[model samples]
Target: MERKCNNLPFLLLMQTSKVIHNQIKEEMAKNKLGITEFSV
Candidate 1:
């Protein structure tokens, strides 16, 4: 018997993460802030 892996959730999570990262990057750029500084 073989087990199948489900990739949809992981792919969706990565996609969502990338979108959020880009949005944060853009916002930080607009504010002239570093990621570490922004996080603090």
Candidate 2:
């Protein structure tokens, strides 16, 4: 239904954010950057 369709993007965004966040963390650790810098 319409509700289920709307939920798809939200779920996708959450999944994508998790992946990006982890990737950023890895990159920050590799270069020794702070959480604030990685967030920005």
lDDT of 1 by residue, 1-40 (tens): 9966589898789889999999999999999999789999
Model 2: residues >4 Å from true position, as ranges? 1-6, 36-40
* RMSD to the hidden true structure, all candidates: 4.9, 4.9
Q: Write the per-residue lDDT of candidate 2 for residues 1-40, one digit (tens) a residue.
A: 3545568888999999999989988899999989888667
Q: Report the CA-based lDDT of candidate 2 relative to the real structure.
A: 0.87
Please give the distance, in angstroms, between residue 38's alpha carbon in candidate 2 and its true position after superposition. Answer: 4.2
Candidate 1 is scored at a TM of 0.74
How high is each candidate's TM-score?
Answer: 0.74, 0.66
lDDT of each: 0.92, 0.87
Kindly give the stretch of ten consecutive residues in candidate 2 with the minimal lDDT sum. Answer: 1-10
